[model samples]
Target chain A: MTNKLAKLIFYLGTLISLVLFLALTFDTHRQIQTLTHADQLSEQVVAGKRVWHKYNCNDCHTILGFGSYYGPDMTKVYWRRGSEGIKAVIRSPEKFTTWRKMPRLPLTDKELEDLVAFLQWTSEIDTQGWPPQDQKLRGAPGRAVTLGVSPGAVLFQEKGCFACHRLYGTGGQQGPELTHVGSRLSYETIEKVLTDPRSTNPQATMPPPMVSHEERDRLAAFLAGMK
Target chain B: MLLAYSSQRVAYPYFLVALLLFLLQVVVGTWLALSYAVTMPQWLVDILPFSTTRAIHTNLLVLWLLLGFMGTTYFMIPEETEREIFSPLLAYLQLTLLVGTGVTAIVGFLLGWTKGKPLLEIPFPLDYLVVAGALIFLFNVGMTVIQAKQWTLIQGSLFGGLVFLAVMYLFNLPFYANLSIDWYYWWWVIHLWVEGAWELVAAALTAWILIKITNVPRELVEKWLYVELGLFLFTGIAGTGHHYYWLGAPKYWLWVGGFFSALEPLPILLMVLDAWHYIRNRRAGLNGRLIFTLAVGMSILHFVGAGFWGFAHTLPQINYYTHGSQVTVAHGHLAFFGAYVLLNIMSFYYAMPRLEGLAEFDERRGTLAFWWMSITMMLMTLAFSVAGVLQTYVERVMGLGYMTAQAQMRFWFAILVVLGLSLLGGVILTVVDLLTLRPALAGAKKA
Candidate 1:
């Protein structure tokens, strides 16, 4: 093509694409408030964001799928770890031993609270189903059927029970083993433990599981049958 | 040296500082790769955390690349406009401000001071210095072009790209309480600078160098430059959508990002073909063999790393899984090295001999450095790609925990550390070769 034609194409194409992008940007701004639940953006969450930046968290962990990949994506972390778990980790990252170590930051209690609030707010944003559910967890119900176990077996996986409790020597060691819990405790006691670990032991570090009354019954029954 | 204008010497210090920073970046990058490969002791973690080191690594890349670009502009504009620079004092001052700010920022990061957005992590106070430096550069170049009252398309493209680059930095200055809003404009600076403004500058520089080495007609080279940059902006502006896909943006971005970014490779392909055609049919006597080879090599890798590798994941379907994984890391290393890093190094190779008053010099050491760096970089990219795919499968797909999956990927990280060390060796060889190069006994001196 001639130089003039190329120049014309360059100008026209750039102008058109830029204009379209601006238009989309405008529309995005309009829709983002509702999509991100902007009304829930509290002063504390905003402070939490500053805390995040001040500590250079994004350099390690990604939020909204932007930033470095050294740590786990924190987009859905609130749902996975809960407020207390997140605070505990941040309070003393060095204490939580893992394959990679998180630097211990000296954060005030208020900063920890704000950071959790920020993460909780992020968890509520509509990411169009990002951080896709793990295939193993998604397939747990089917595997439960294959194993002839109660639906609670699938619930155990979905609820991240394996992170703290072991049944067949496949889970974490922070919590007591439930392999023969049926012989040690009845279904009623098991249900109470699921509902309120603090009730069983005031010093319990486990946050109360966020299950419904029915889910607690099923989980208790599933554990009671372990014998 | 037979410089057309004495002021072109301003580029010399810029090139020197850029090379120093480039070497530093590689060293820090190697340390980072090693961190992933092996666990660090508590004392080291306390002193230099991964986050701090990572910030330094990336910030150094930006600082050095910008210096290279500025140095290149200083070298080219006086020749293009047929006049001396507007003010060498301002140019040197700009460099000092930039390098000073870079040093302070690195030190600050170690001291736990940061604004903490990924690439734009210079503390809030230092950012103003960066802006001031940019403005000074723009003013210096702008005045030089205006005083001459004569401009070529290549000169126009370079100046326009520089202006676009400076204006784009404004988007990075604002603070948005909402993260989605923050990232939305953040991509404006990060994405647009690379694909949009930087491409324009690359196209202009590539065109200028092609004309110098191949003795091609200026009109023909400028024509392709126009077409290349035209195609670049057409696809790249809308291609910013790709970054928006999982960042809590509107849903339509999926289609917009996927479709537009898929077309982004077309211009890079044209660039590869254009460079190939010009090199093949050039005049019988070839000068600056190292420069020619680097230029051609840069084009090919630009296509492979930025174009092909980027296309592999630009589509939302695949990126949905790969967005924050090592897949992005794989693409990032290659794309930056192939496009910007190689381009800057090519400028160094092209200008250094001429600046030293030599008509010709031995290309053997330079050629070896090129191949060593290139091969090791590609291998490093391959290692990251393997690690990325495995991480995605085991972690994202299989639902394994992050630490668990990372444990499995340690072998690949080990490989990356080895490749990085090799790459650093190449960089050292390059620095040694470039710094030690001299005219041979039989080499002709420039008039």
Candidate 2:
């Protein structure tokens, strides 16, 4: 091709693409408020975003699939770990130690609340089904029931119990392996330990189990049946 | 044997600093890989947490690459414009400001000061210094090109790319209340800079090097440069959509991103063909075998890593499963190494001998370093890919928790750590060869 033709192609192609990109960007801006629930972007959520930056959280954790891969993606974190779970971990990351530990940051109560609020806002944004839900976890309880897995097994996965405690050959090493917990503790003792770990051993670092009495019973039975 | 212009010597320090920073980047990166494979000591973790170390690693990559680009510009512009640099003193000042800012940023990150965005984590105040440095660089180069008033297509493209790069950084400086809005513009800086601006820069540099090495007619090389970069901007600007698909953008982005990004590989393919065509039709015997090999190697891996590996997961359907997983990491390592890193190293190999006024130099050690670095990087990419695939299957597909999935991928991470150490050895070899290789004597045969 001649220089003039090549230059024309260069200018025209770049111009066309730039124009299209800007048009899409403009339309995206128009629809963004509704898509992201801009009305719900509270002061606390903004403060939480500041907290996120102040602590350099994105350096480890990804939000909206952006940032480093050192920590887990925090887009759906509000759904994965509830507000209380998030607050607990932030308040004392040492207590939630696992294979991949989150470093402890000295966040105040207000920062903790704000960060959770920001995460909540992020969870609510429509990601267009990005980070596709795990096929097994989609209707896990029902699938477990069909597969003859106990409700307690489903709760174990849902409550993220396996994050700290291992069963069989899988899971974290932070807590003792529970492959044969049924052989050691009766259902009553297991339930007591789940309800109040500090009662069983005052040195127990496990926080009080965040479950209803029925969930506690189901988990105890599941562990009791593991022998 | 001497450089065509004395002002070209200004690039020597830029290249030296870039390589030094490159070594530091690899060190931090290897440490990160080790941390992933095995738990680091608690005291070490308390002092240099993964977050701090990771920030340092990525920021170092950016800093080194920028230095490389600036050096390449300084070296090439004098030849292209047929004049001295507009202001060599200003160039040195820019370098000092940038390096100072980088050192301070690393120390600040350790002291708990950051803006917290990945890659853009060079705290708020230091960012201004970066912007100022960029402005100074632009002014100096802009004046050089403007005063020459004899613009070749290569010089024009190079200037355009530099200006575009500087302009894009403005996007990262703002804060948005909405996270979606935040990321939308964030991609403007991150995605657009890589796919759009940096591609332009790489294209010009590659074309300039090919013209110099092959003794090809300027018209012929510049023609291909125009066509290739034209196609690049055509596909790349909209290819920004691929990043938009999952970041709370409109659903239409899924289609836009998928369609445009699929075409993104075409220009890169064209680039490879363009280089091959010029290399095959060269008029003279090949000189600087190591530099030629690196240039050719850059083209091949650029196609494989950025073009092929990028296309591997650019589709929304595949990306949905792989986004934020090890799959992205796999693509990232290969793409950056193949595209930008090799380009910089190639420039160093091409320019260093001439900058030192050597007619020829022993190249065996350089060649050995080349193979070592390239092969190890390819292997590391493979290790990360295997781990990514397994992680996706276990964590995303099987619904395992993050730690459980990570447990399964430890074997691959172990492989990565070993490969990273090997890569470090290669880097050390390169540094040694660059520093210690002596000039060949007159009447001696080139290696």
Candidate 3:
């Protein structure tokens, strides 16, 4: 029994030594930029991260391909949507999307700005080749000097049609895919469906959004761009 | 049968509930597997999302195994201490509260009331109930040990595991501040409990099985038990580095994590090889040789599935490519089945039928289930391994998007679904046999 106890002690000591080794490695691996100097998140950006967690965003979205596969990868979302686009969608998402999906968490201006910063910060992480081109928009070089988030794209997500309809085979499955919607529908029919779904299909469950004629036009042009 | 009558009585409630929940866990797991192979409807996806499915599959696994651990304690402690449990009434009450709260939480998850931490998604209020349940359990078992002042090595090891499990669970109580730090601490809870504490349970249980059936001297068996405990502490603690590689932690973890975790399999390898030699060379436990042989076989499977496949992905360089890929899924399935699933089943095999007063412990239906379940799980692991590697190459190496990569691996995922269903079938049969045998024992006037 004493011999076995001695062997046990010897093994425990060896294990404790490895723990120290792991700690030593942790200290050496600290990022100089984040831990030491100017690379830290600004006070607002830090608050935005808190907002991200507060709503349990990771439940629906993958950051670096770790979380749920329900929503799009948010690793480079800042680049995909831009600052203005993110704000418009978050501000009054119900006015923008189709389904009651992606809950509208009412955020103050400061919280919105912080969330954008937080997203921008995440976009800068060295994700090691995550979220290939499908998630990003690679338009022609004629549009090289890029602009803010497109209002159409914001409306598409905000209005929740994406929840019911697939775009290039990504969203929920109830409705026809919007990826080839432009090829199948003329501009007038697209407008008609947006303004009044029952006019196009008598059994359609879609409730027409209360947006004005101009917003309806913009939404039509957005659906037209899907092809 | 050698245990105090009270010990045997307390054990029945725990084993019965655990087996029923085990069936529920397998059914949910089969659903998650089938969803990957078929196109689930959009509205259905919205209601029972893949995340919800995955959460239910994984959490049910943890809950049922935890239930089994309590069963393990109730069954083993009295035998080890040579005394009856302090209170059988508390044991029954504890099972009702634990299983009731667990079922409620599972229902809550379906309705989308989750905190959304993967594997730890049992919400806040349920966490309190779990704590209360564990404490009540610990008190009942602790009271028994206090009443009987004799302490055995097997009981000591098991008690250590239970205490550590309760303590580690409290790590989830606090709200973490940063995502990286949150994940960093999360792995400590996950890795330590799986690789550290539960190992003590495995060792004690394996030791108990070997001691009862075999002619191995108590001195020799106890000495090896110490060695298993020592090795577990050595590897499981430092082996947690494998999880820290990409969590934005230190760079040296690449080497430190990979190297130490690579060594984690050494003890399992030793335990299996030792058991194999004893079984082949000597017929010490032939009276109940069938279950004894299976218990040995599971140790080998644990070594290969958890130990071997785990090392395959632990290397920092390999993980850099395979992180979050199907490869990790493959590892998780094999490791979990080989380690915890096999270990728990072996415990039930030892305790339940004997308690049911079967004239002979080796029933043909159960033996068939064991072989069927083990074979199908290995095939499923193979399917997962091939699919994961292909996914990493196509998605990470070729820079394809997630869905496109999933499309490329469709064939393997189909195989996985088929094998998963077969394995589920085997589990159902085994659980049914366990259920019916209890009544058979009662009718025979054995209890």
Best by DockQ: 1
Error of 1 at B43 (Å): 3.2
After TM-score superposition, the amount by which residue B109's alpha carbon in candidate 2 deviates from its true location, in angstroms, is 1.1
Q: Give candidate 3's error at residue B372 in angstroms.
A: 1.0
Ranking by DockQ: 1, 2, 3
TM-scores of the candidates in the order shown:
0.90, 0.90, 0.79
CA-based DockQ, model 1: 0.55
**Which stretches of candidate 1 lie above 4 Å from their native place?**
A134-227, B441-447
Per-residue lDDT over B1-447 for candidate 2, one digit per residue giving the tens place of the 0 to 100 score: 469999999999999999999999999999899889887765666667899999999999999999999999999999989999999999999999999999999999889888888899987889989999999999999999999999888887788988889899998888888999999888888888889889999999999988888988999888878888888998999889998888878999999899889998888998888888888898877665787788888888888888998999999888888888887888888889989999998888888888877767888788898899999999988888988898788877766677777888888898888898899999988887776667765554653
Clashes of each: 0, 0, 9
For residues B1-447, could you state the per-residue lDDT of candidate 3 as single tens digits?
433465566777787888887888888877776766676654665467676767777888888888887887788887777878888889889998998888888898777777667788788899899999999998999889888998877788888878887888888877754455566667667888888888888788788767766656666777767777777777777778787675555566677778778888988987887676555655363454447647776887898888988888888778877776677777788788878887788788777866777645436667788889888988988898888888778866765554566777778877877887898899998898777753223332321
- Docking quality level of the chain pair in candidate 3: incorrect
Name the lDDT value of residue B334 in candidate 3: 76
Model 1 compared with the native: what TM-score? Answer: 0.90
Selected candidate, larger DockQ, 2 vs 3: 2
Arranged by lDDT with the best first, the candidates are: 1, 2, 3
Cα lDDT of model 2 by residue, A86-188, tens digit: 7767776767765667777789889998999999898888888757642222343344345453668777655656545666544545677877888998988
In candidate 1 the C-alpha lDDT for residue B97 amounts to: 95
Model 3 error, position A11 (Å): 4.2
